[model samples]
Target chain A: MTVIDVRNLRKEYGPHVAVDDVSFSVEHGEIFGILGPNGAGKTTTVECVEGLRRADAGTLEVLGLDPHADGKRLRRRIGIQLQESQIPERLKVWEALDLHSSFYDTPTDWGRLLDDWGLAAKRDTPFAKLSGGQKQRLFIMLALVGSPELVVLDELTTGLDPQARRDTWELIERVRAGGVTVLLVTHFMEEAERLCDRVMVIDAGRVVAVDSPSGLISRAVPEQRVRFRPSAPLDERLLTGLPEVTRVSMTGTRVEVSGNGDLLHAVTSVLARHRIVAADLRVDQPSLDDAFVALTASRPHGSGGSPGASEGASDHRRG
Target chain B: MTALTKYELKLFLRDPAATLIVLVLPVGIVALFGVVMSPGGGDAIETFFPSAAIALGLGQLGMNLLPSTMAGYREKGILRRMAGTPVHPAALLGAQLVVGALFALVSMALVVAVGVVAFGFGPPGSIPAFLLTFVLGVMSLFAVGLLVASIAPSGRVATGIGVAVFFVSIVFGGVFMPVESLPAFIADVGDFTPLGAFMRALRASWAGAWPEPLHLGVMAVVALGFSLLSAKMFRWE
Candidate 1:
């Protein structure tokens, strides 16, 4: 079942069109990702879908309910944790959990959440006293407190240390294992590449590309890179002459051979005959960030719609 | 609804800044007035006590009460946090108003008890008129307080604005001065403001002094209007 369906959604904040004619769908229980650069309309699009922002024009259905007309009801069925919303500075860790848990009708066990989020030790500490990783864990625990079928997480791991980031990733996998659909709004290419089943790269408020991570990388920049440290010297003429070699360009010890079919064997045959034995060889594949840069480089800058004004804007009351 | 009310009360009571602004400051304002002026104008304790209570209530409800309550909630993001909850935002407003009323009543009692015991203050000719003043005073001040909170972007801003308004209303509204003692223009302005009418009606009812009903009615109307507007314009985030 498609839990969320957004068709030709457009959200304009004055001059800049934040989300421009964007369309996408999220299947039930799928870990879908909306990926883009800093100013991409990924957050805006998700906010519109979550019923936080009313699109200038669009039709949105979340969990088979209209986001705008039935916003309150839909919100009750889902869990949302905003990017910058840390619990109040004075609120104790357990107090924060208890307060948030009270907002839902059938809440997850408070004690269970404490243990699950690894916040049991810090239960008595106030929010201001918490470390960055501790605070992030508390937020994640709060987000899952209601046990909703669909969870909307906006930039879940923006500023965590490496170890904390990995722990968060594991927690996300755990949440997915429980059968909850996740709508992740993020700019981290590694996160999208690692966790997202299928990715949507939005640029200038429009869908530029959508597919699995490997699929996107391959589709955008196909072929493996041939790199090797020359044991002696390489004969460029014979290597370039191979039928599978589409392009060959090199400087110093590094050499890039791009082409199709049996290139390893074909290049090896040429090197062996020429008495060039290459050491320290590596076959490189493009990462999600590389594909991300390739995809959004063409988009206009500041497409996220007033990144500066967004901080002070009072319009956050809706979405 | 209960959760919102409880949360508001918890936050209102827990916030160190709000605790001082709403609970301590108003009581301090009242204590200052009691120390500065001698109670009773020779008629009886009834004559002077009610007027003192009115002055103290205004200090509690109007000047100190409204601004800090609203501003504090806005500043703490308590209002914003409550907005997203299953609890209705209306209940949150109601909770603040109730809390203001709660603290105002306690302050009024404390001020009155201290006045009667220390300054030989007494009640008014009619117990009913005095009770009316208390009821009207609480409502009027709560409305004005809501208005202040509605307008302020943060608690600190609200506190600054609230304190300024409180002193102005107290000095010009005749809470500290007799109407005849004020310049005519100042007295006229006082009649229109809720604080002015509250003090006038309260003094008159207590000292066997009587002012036009129009003053009381006008303040009541302003309070009602402000209460509605505050609830309407309030923002959570």
Candidate 2:
């Protein structure tokens, strides 16, 4: 079932358009990522989905309820961890959880949440005293205390250390494991690649593409490169003539082969026939970071485009 | 809503400095002055000490502290965070008002206790009139504080504005001196101001009479007007 459905969502700040004609849907029980650079309207888009902002033009349905019209009811079932939002500095950890739980009709037990989120030791600590990671954990715990069916986490790990980011990712995965749908907004490609079941790439308030991590990588960059140091002198023509080998270049004793479709097998089989050992072999497949750069960079500029225009054309070609 | 108010009360108490200022300062004022004045001397000027003490406490809570705290909540995005939940941000605002009122009442009680028991100062001349005037005074002062909170862009700015307004109100409202000694024109002008009217009404009730209609009307008008303006201007973020 679709948990969140937003179509042609447009929001503006006076003359400055923040989100323009964006469209996407999050499926139930899956982590959906909205990936974009700063000022790309990622936060504005989710703010609409969370029913915090009224879209100037568009339709948004969360759990089959209109977000703006049924906001009070919608808010009950969806937990939100907003960017730059904070608890009172003097409020204790347990008090925040207990207080927020009272806002929901059927809240989960906060004591268990404290244990689950590893915050039991810090229960008495004031919010200002917690380290960044602990504060983040408490926020996630508060988000879950409402027993929500879906949670919207906006830049949850933006300021954390690398270890804390990894730990937060694991916690997010745990949230999904409990059958709650998650909508994660992030600019980090690795985060989306690791945790998102599918990602919607938005740029300049427009939808660039929507696909799984690997799907995006493959779609944006179809070719892979293989680098190896050959033990013996190699003929350039032998690799150039192969069907999978699009280009082959020699750098000193190192051979670089680039192509699509069975390129590794094709090049390795050729090396075997020549009886030349391929040393320090490395297969460099394009990563999500590469795909993100390629997709956003290739977007057309000037003359504001329609929502998902390029996404539609790309889908047609893929089909 | 009760949970929100309880937590808000806890948060207020956690700040020892603020709690001390709200409770200790007023009681301390009454204590210091009660010793010097030698109450029950049958001088009406004795009323100035207790009334000024209570007014000072309310002004600090409503004018200096409340605006800064509420603005800080907006500056820190606490209000915005609550907006995403099942509860409205207005509930938080209401909780703050409730907490502030609670502190004001406690502080007033402490001032009265110290005045009546330790100094032999008489109780309010009319209990019902005193209560009515007290309620109006709190509403008017807090309404002005909410207005300050609404217009200020940040917590620091709100604190600056609150302090400025507080000093001005205390000076012109007769907290610094008895209104009877001020210039006739100044006293007349003070009658129209919220704090000025509040002090007069409080003094009237303590002297065993109902507050003047002009004083009551001034407090009511300021309370209603500022409340509506703040509600219209308040922002979640």
Candidate 3:
């Protein structure tokens, strides 16, 4: 079931178009990602769908109601964690949570949620006093307090260490398991790749590509790269005739075998067959980040060119 | 509307400056100012008591109360945050007015209490006249406070403007100085200003029936216009 659907949405701020003819639908209990660079209108599009902004042109329905026309009802059902979660600087974390909960007809208890978000000890701390991670956690906890049917998280993890990022990812998975539909707007490709069941790559307020991470990568470029550092300089001829090898390139002792799948085994086996020892072997797979870079790089300056323009823009080689 | 009003009243009271100016400060100022104006005699205490009460109400409201409300809210971004909510932004303008009125009412009661307790200050014979004057004085000063907040860019500026306005008005408004001793223009200007009218209305009420309904009526128009203008000009993020 489609929980939310946005079709040909357009919003302009005077002469500048913030969200241009964008369209996508979120399914029941699915994690949907909208990936784009900063100022790419991902947040604007999401805000429009959330009924925070009035669309200049488009049709948007969340939970079977128009986002703008039925905004009051839609707001009650959808929980939004905006790009900037602003709370009063003087307000304590617990106080803010309680105040936000007051707006909803039925809200989750702050006591349990405080512990869940690892903010029990910081209950009395003012909002400005919390660390960045702690603030983000509190912001998310406030968004979830209403037990909303649809959750929208914008740039959920922009600044966090690796471990914190992973923990947030696990929390998101838990949210998904609770049968809540999530629509995420983010600039982090790795986050999109790891979490999104399906993602829409937006550039300058338009959907350039939409598919699973692997699906989009494969669609853009169907090549695998195998890389290895041989004990000494490797001759190009030894790897030139392998069945799986389409292109063999060697930069000093770092040999990169560009071909389809199983090229790594083929290259290693052939090297061994010839008594050529290899070390520090690394396999480079075409990633969502690479595909995104390729698609966005080719797009017209701020106008946001076609999808797949950013492909090959990064140094992506498998070893 | 009433629910929002109640909520605004609660929030406004939470401010330290607001609590001081409205709830506690007015009561204190009235008693303290009453001492300065008190002349010890049979009729001296009664005559001076009403004047001092009116003076305290006017001084605190114009000088220390409403300006702080405007500046504090601007600093906290309270107005901007409220603007985005389902509540009508105009309600906030109304909320500020209600808070001022609350303070005004509290000030009136404190002065009346202190007037009777320390210095026998109540109407000679006419009850209605004295009460009418007290109410009008509050309305006039509250109007002036609103105008100052609307014009001041920040709380500090408002505070400066408020103090200046209060001192000028109290000195010339005939609280301590008689109208006959002042320059004709200064006396005339004081008569026309809300503070002047407030003092006249309160003094007349003590004498008998309110001396001038027109003065009170004009203040109503000014207060209405000032509040409406505040709604139009208030800035929010």
Candidate 4:
């Protein structure tokens, strides 16, 4: 079932456009991500879906109900953790959980939730007293207390240490494993690559691409690389002559090859045939981080309306 | 709603400013005046000091404490966070009102107790009328506070406006001088203000008479008008 369907979504802040004709649909049980840079309107788009902001144009439906028109009904079934929302500083962790529980009709047992989120011992600690990671863990617990079918988490791992971020990623996976569809809005490429089933890359209020992590990487930067130091001096034409190799360069007795489709197999076979054994060979495929940079940075700034302009430019470059 | 109210009450009690304003200040005001100002204490000290204490407490809670709490919640995004839930954002305001009114009543009771124990002041002659007047008085002042909360953009601004209103309300309520001592025209205008109307009704009940209809009507109208306007003005963000 499509839990959320947003078509031609448009929102603007006065003269400046925030979300421009954005559209996407999320199926049940998929950890969908809206990956974008700062001021990319990722938050605005989700706020419209959460019914926190009214969309200026377009059709949005969540759980088969209009978000703005049926906000009360939608709020009951969906949980939202806003980007920078906060509870009272003096409010204790347990009290915050208990108070949020009162807002839902059938809240999960808060005691168990505390233990699961590693916040049981800190339950009596005030919000001001908790560390940043502990506070984020509590926020997640509050988001899940109602056992919502769909949970929207925005920038949940923004300011955490490496280990803490990894732990939060695991927790998010656990949330998805519990049969809940997750909508995550984040700028972290590695986080999206690890958690998202598919991602919609939004840049400057426009959809750049929508695909799985690997799909986006392949679509953006298809050239895979192979680098090695030659055991003996070899001719560069040996690599450049191959059909799979698009570009080859050499420096200081080391050679590098970049091409599309099975470049590793092609280069290794050629090296084997030429009796030039390669040492310290390394293969590199573009990461989502690389793809994200290419996807967003490739656009000529402020040219969103004419979609084919950038596409044509890239085509010219490829040709 | 009960759970929210309980938590809000806990927060109120735990706050040092709320404790000082709602619990300690009123009692201190009554004691200060009863001992120092009314050395040759008589019916006037017994009646006027306790009434003034109630007015002072209401002014502090309604204009200062209530608005500050509401604006603080909004400033810190507490209301916005709660807006995502099935619970209405107004629930926080409602809980705040409940807790503030509760503390006002407690403060009034303590002032009355101090008046009796410390200065041999007499109790209100009409119990039922006193209770009615107290509830009405609380409603009127809290409504004004809610209006301030709804309009102030931040906690600091709210506190500033609240204090400004507090001084203005108390001056007209005859905390500095008896209403009888004020010029007739000023007293007439004072009857329409929350603290002024409250004082008139409280005095009447203390003197063993039902409050004048005009004073009661002023409270009703101000309470209704301010509450409706503030409710409309309040923004979750």
Best by DockQ: 2
**Candidate 2, residues A50-84: lDDT per residue as tens digits?**
88889999889999999989999999998999999
Worst 10 residues of 2 chain B by lDDT: B37-46
Docking class of 3: incorrect
Off by over 4 Å in 3: A124-129, A156-170, A219-225, A240-246, A259-263, A285-287, A302-319, B1-14, B39-104, B119-215, B226-236
Q: What interface RMSD do all candidates show, one decimal each?
A: 3.0, 0.5, 4.4, 0.9
Better by lDDT, candidate 3 or 2? 2
lDDT of 1 by residue, A1-319 (tens): 9999999899888777777778889998888999876666777888787777798897898999998778778777788766565545676878777877777888889898788767898988988899888877887777787778788788888998888888888888888888999988887888888899989987666677788988888766666677777777666777778888888888888787887667777887778877778787777677877677766653444343321112121111111
Docking category of candidate 4: medium
Query: What would the DockQ be for model 2?
Result: 0.89
TM-scores for all candidates: the values are 0.85, 0.96, 0.77, 0.90
Per-residue lDDT of candidate 4, residues B27-73 (tens digit) = 98788877776533345545777898888878888888899889988
Per TM-score, the best of the predicted structures is 2
Report the C-alpha displacement of residue B230, candidate 3, in angstroms. Answer: 4.8
Question: Please, what are the lDDT tens digits per residue for candidate 3 over residues A1-319?
Answer: 9998899998888777777768888899999999977667887888788777789998988899887777767777777786644564666788777766665677888799899777899998987898877877887787787778888888889888777788888888878888889898888888999999999987766677888888888766567898878885667888888888899887766888898767788888988887778888888888988888876666644434434443322221111
Q: Model 4 over residues A16-42: C-alpha lDDT tens digits?
A: 888876899999999999997787789
TM-score of 3: 0.77
Q: Give iRMSD, candidate 3.
A: 4.4
Candidate 3 CA-lDDT value: 0.71
What lDDT is reached at residue B96 by model 1? Answer: 63
